[model samples]
Every structure is written in structure tokens, then in C-alpha cells.
Target: MMLDSETTKTYTRPISKAWWLRDRGHFNRRYFMFLLRELTSVFVALYVVLFIYEIFLLTKGPDAHTAFRESLSAGPWIAFHIIALLFALYHSYTWLGLTTKMQAAGRGLVKIGTKTLPPILIALGSYGAWIIATCIIAYLFLTL
Candidate 1:
């Protein structure tokens, strides 16, 4: 005996191309921040590409590398660097803060003995390490 079966079509709601840009016909602070964070990632990726390109330029000879560095000192390039730096800083802050957020949400807790660490301490420790590393790098670069 053959069994009879009915095939059902799955329904999918069509999404607009700009759905991420629009949230329920309006924009909110949380949505705006989400977009900003995503945009920062683009800036960060561009920064990484630019850094790699700079490294590649070094292989072309000092003149070529110096020219690239000089061009980057121009007003527009300076502004772009500043903007990218801001975005990168914001991105890093949010990325590192995720640990604290997770702790607060009771999702990814770090335990010491039988007690879980608080979010504020987690945030401070992460940011503190960042500051220390930044200072050390800056010191080495400035000395060099």
C-alpha cells in the first residue's frame, strides 16, 4: 500500500532592501546605535586594508612609501584618519564591553572561586588593559 502525502508550500515574508535602515516605519536610538556600530566595522576594515597597503608599499621602496605617507598627511586624509580612529575606538569599546554586557546578562560569567565577577569590574579591567597597552605602544613609538 502506498501512503498519500500532501505537500505544503512554505510562506516567507518579503523583506525590503532598506529594512535594516528602517525599524517598524521609524528609527530609534537603539537602531541608530546598531547601524553606527556596523558602520564602525566598515571603517575598521578599511583601516586594516589601508595598513596592509602601507606595509605593501614599504616593499616598493622608501620613496614610494614616503610619498604614500606624505599624501596621507593631506587635510582630507587627516580628516579621514581622525574619523576612522573615532570609529575604531568606538568599535573596540563596544566589542570589549560585550564581555561586561554578557556578564550583566548572566550569559558569559567569569567566576573566581564560587563568586561571579561583576560587570563593572569586568569593564574596568578590559578598558584598563586597553589603556595600558595603548600607553606602552605610544611610548615605544614615540621613543623610536
Candidate 2:
């Protein structure tokens, strides 16, 4: 059973049983930066909500603040931070990559801004952040 090329749909290639065997490296950007951006957005939203809830509890009374702070000492606390760390890293990478794209500028549309920062420099910053984050995570694993 195979998905007919005419009936199947993908930006670069049709869905098929042989999809896994297909050279996906050549696949288009349809499944792309938007996903990473959305994911990071979701994580940021969750963080805001969680912190807001904590603030609410703090305003309610001292016991609530104690419970909220105590929650951070447990396993779930570590998991939350780990997920946040991954989302944050992806967000940074995507932002830096997209930023380097040349943009047309000026009200007359006669000029172009060729990019203030070099792509390699932005890439280095992104990679540098990843290395620093990985080291921190490794340290946490060893000590915690």
C-alpha cells in the first residue's frame, strides 16, 4: 500500500510508506522554523502562567509561598527547568538565524540593509550558548 503521489501532499514530497527512506535532507522548509518558534512561545507562555500563579499564591498568604518554593526542590522542578532550557536554546538559535537575512530598508525602498551582524558571528553566539547550557546541565546532573 503506497500513498499516491497525486493524492498525497507535502511541500517537498508526497506522503508515502517510503517516506522514511526518502532523502529528507532535501525536504523543503515547510516543516520549519515556525514550529520551533511556536514551541518556544508555548514554553514562555507556560512560564508566565506558572509564575503568575505563584504570585497569586504569594498574595493569598505565607503558606502558599512556602508551598510554591518547596515545589522547586522536587523532581518536577528539575524537569520544568530542563524543558525550559531546551525551548530557550531553540528560540535563540532561530532568532539569530533569521536575523541575518538581508532586509530591504529606507522609505523610498531604494536601499537595502545588508545585515549589521555577520551570520557566522550570530551562529557562534548560538553555539556558544548551547555549550554553556550543556555544561550547566551536566554540572547540575553531577551535583544534584
Candidate 3:
């Protein structure tokens, strides 16, 4: 059975454009961090775009690629890279920790046999794997 539209009216609360910024008490450190985490994606996307552009520049011959390389070697470019690296690191850290949060939420993302693994263990495993991979890559890069 369908209810009458007049009798079953729903109220939609009016929210400000800067709702996130408006609520100082409700939007605490966690909310700010969440926003920061989201902002990290912009830097990551920018770096990916730059990398693709560099690859495209390579196809345009040595002179174009050399100019791009020279521009990247400048102070401002170096600072941008450093900032991007920090944001990228933060993004990666938060991403890897998400598994632990999910597991801890009792969703059973990490389970062994009938028993569910602890959140800390899940976090450790992810971070450990990341460290191992980084070490291997670093080793290869240094050697080759």
C-alpha cells in the first residue's frame, strides 16, 4: 500500500556549504584527518599525471625530455616533489591501516580457521609486507 504524499512528508535539514568547517565540536581531529586523507589523492593524481606527461615528452625526442628534466630539477619542482612524497606516504599509511579498522569493526576481514585475527596483527602484516616490498625495490634500484 502507498501512503499519501501530504501525510508522509519528509523533512530535509538545511545544511551549509561549509558544513564540515562549521561544526567545530563535532568535526574534530578525526574529521580533519579524514579530509586530509582525501586531499592526498589530489597530490597522488598530480604525480601520476606528471609521470605520464614525462613519458609523452620522451616520445617528443631528447630536447623536449631534457627540458622537462631540467624544469623538474629546479627548487620549486623539488619542493613540490617533497610535498607530494609526504602526502603519498600519508595516503599509503592510512590505506594500509584501513584493513585493520575493517577487521576491528567485526567484519571478519582477517580470519584464520574459525577464529578471527586481531586488528593489530592485520595492521602489522600489511605494514610488514609493505616494508619487505620497499626493501626489495630499494635493493634492486641500488644494485641496478
For each predicted model, how many residue pairs clash, with residues at least 3 apart or on different chains?
Answer: 0, 0, 0
For candidate 2, the clash count comes to: 0
Better of 2 and 3 by lDDT: 3
**Each candidate's TM vs. the true structure?**
0.82, 0.51, 0.82
- Per-residue accuracy of model 2 over 1-144 as CA lDDT, tens digit each: 555669777345445543433335454454444556777988888888888998999898998899888888799888997999799778876665553342212222113384344455645765677789889999999999
lDDT of 3 at 13: 56
RMSD of 2: 9.6
**How do the candidates rank by TM-score, highest first?**
1, 3, 2
Residue pairs in collision within model 1: none
Query: Over the full model, what C-alpha lDDT does candidate 2 score relative to the true structure?
Result: 0.68
Give the Cα lDDT of each candidate.
Answer: 0.87, 0.68, 0.88
Residue 132 displacement (Å), model 2:
15
Q: Which numbered prediction scores highest in lDDT against the true structure?
A: 3
Ranking of all predicted structures according to lDDT, beginning with the best and ending with the worst: 3, 1, 2
When 2 and 3 are scored with TM-score, the better candidate is 3
- Output the lDDT of residue 99, model 2: 34
